[model samples]
Target: MSKNIIITGTSRGIGFELVQLFAKADYNVLALSRNSKPIEALELKNVIALSFDLSKKDDYKKVESFIGSNWKQVDVLIHNAGTLLNKPFVETSMEDFEHVYKTNVFGVTELTRIAIPFMQRTSHVVTISSMGGVQGSMKFPGLAAYSSSKGAVITLTELLAEEYKETGPSFNVLALGAVQTEMLEEAFPGYQAPTTALEMAQYIFDFSLNGNKYYNGKILQVSSSTP
Candidate 1:
């Protein structure tokens, strides 16, 4: 049977490429993004694209309903959608932090909560984080809100893995470096990244399928160069 996969942030960059990779591999993909036009335009086979906003509580129900009505099971769930704010800490407002956390942290939590019941021991949950989230690593200015939100998800993944260890649905997070995506450009303008969106998505696509075999609740640093 073809596996059912849910991937967020599918409007562009890594998430966009990921949707294609899974679809071409014969997996049933549910691509969610705030803007569904990009994925819908592709018209790929075995794929369903929805305009989903992570920060909105109601958006999760749409995902649950889709699964319940069509898939009835989730083989993989990848939290790839994230919001980034490029502003100095002193200049960033409380709303800025909340906005970032809303989507990156709380959003991940709610979706996983809704999807867990549909997943089995063999299921995998892959979260796409950033190297900026890694402690003791190089820190950059003007990213207090964005980077911290990414960091929060790292811990969230760890806790979920431990809690679910006895039951199933292995969890792991990838702390990626500067990938040449729109998000990267927004964070650091004009700075070219060594890896492309497709390249990174390819790695994530493979890992999401097999990494659970040997690892769980671990943070893998996937970066070739610093930002």
Candidate 2:
């Protein structure tokens, strides 16, 4: 059987582009997203697209069950599913914070927890974060919840890498700069980004293929500027 990869948020943007890249490379991509239409439209023989909202515990639990039963080994697991809340800290409510964290942090944690048992000895776990999570960066007014959750992602990735050092899988996070995606448009509105989703996808694809060999327990700052 071909090598397997599990990636979240494959409906569009980086996740969709990643499925294309990996599928072209002959890797069996277990693509999970909230919508099945886009995945089905890909028509790639190697891609297995499952539709489920990552933020919903019940929906993600189904994913855990499917993977546990069907997958013997996962080579790479990319946590790319995330939500953006572009509201001021004062306006951000507890429910808003929980909503953002549910998908960006909690869902990722739970999915990784379930996937750990099936990961290969050299497996790599990559989480896509944001430059907004970086400290000392220009504080954008409307990203309190979003930025904090990504900060949690960075911390979570570090801890997991150290905790699993003796086990097998290597954990790392990419603190992405502005990338041209729907999410970017939603957050930054009218601002132009230096990188495109496809460009970022290529970088992530190459890293996912070989990053674990050289880097582990690190936060890779992937941005064009200090943004």
Candidate 3:
């Protein structure tokens, strides 16, 4: 049977690339994003476009509805929808921090929670995090709120992995470094990004299907130089 994968933020960038790759690999894909319009260029069978805001609480219900109307089990869930805020720590407002956390941390957490029961045993949950989650890299400045939010996501990934250690699905986070996406453009205007979305998507797809149990609960870093 073909694996069923659900990818968020599929309107563009890494998420869009992932949808294409997985669909090409003969996997059933449910692509979710605010822009639910179908991409005529990606005319692949076994692919469905879903519209929902990951930052909102009601979006989980929309996901549930989609799943209920389609597949029975989810083989993989990729949390790729995230927001980045760049400003001095002193200038960062509480609202900005809350907004970032809601999407990066709380939203992801809720989606994973709702997806657990629908996921099959040994299913994989891949969260697209960043090196910012680990440490504030020098390339970008005044991103404390975004970095801190991703840090929470990393912690959540570890805890979820441990919680499901006995019988639940596997959880992992990808700490991507400088991927060339809209988020990067928004974070650092005019700066050249080191990684491409297609490359990162391919790596993520390979990692998810490799069935390497050891990767669970670990943060895998993806850079152009390091495979």
Instruction: Report clash pairs, candidate 1.
Output: none
Among these predictions, the greatest lDDT belongs to 1
- Candidate 1 versus truth, CA RMSD in Å, comes to 0.6
**Per-residue alpha-carbon lDDT of candidate 2 for residues 1-227, written as tens digits (9 for 90 to 100):** 67889999999899999999999989988899988789889799888888878777787677777777777688899999999999878888999999999899898998898889888769999999998887766668889899989999999998999899988799989999989999989997788989999999999999987999998889899999645
1 or 3, which is superior by lDDT? 1
Q: What is the lDDT, from 0 to 100, of the residue 156 in candidate 3? A: 88
Candidate 2 clashes between residue pairs 3 or more apart in a chain or in different chains: none
Q: What lDDT score is found at residue 141 in candidate 1?
A: 98
TM-scores of the models, in the given order? 0.99, 0.96, 0.92
Instruction: Give the C-alpha miss distance for residue 16 in model 2, angstroms.
Output: 0.8
- In candidate 3, what are the lDDT values of residues 66-161, reduced to their tens digit? 887788788899999888888998898889898888888888988888889888667999998888777544344688888888788888889988
Error of 3 at 189 (Å): 2.0
How many Å off is the CA of 207 in candidate 2? 0.5
Task: Arrange candidates, best TM-score first.
Answer: 1, 2, 3
The regions of model 3 sitting more than 4 angstroms off are 38-41, 135-139, 224-227
Candidate 1, which ten residues in sequence have the lowest lDDT sum? 55-64
User: Which candidate do you rate higher for lDDT, 2 or 3?
Assistant: 2
- Can you write out model 1's per-residue Cα lDDT over 1-227, one digit (the tens) per residue? 99999999999999999999999999999999999999999999999999999998888889999999999999999999999999979999999999999999998999999999999999999999999999988889999998998899899899999999999999999999999999999999999999999999999999999999999999999999997
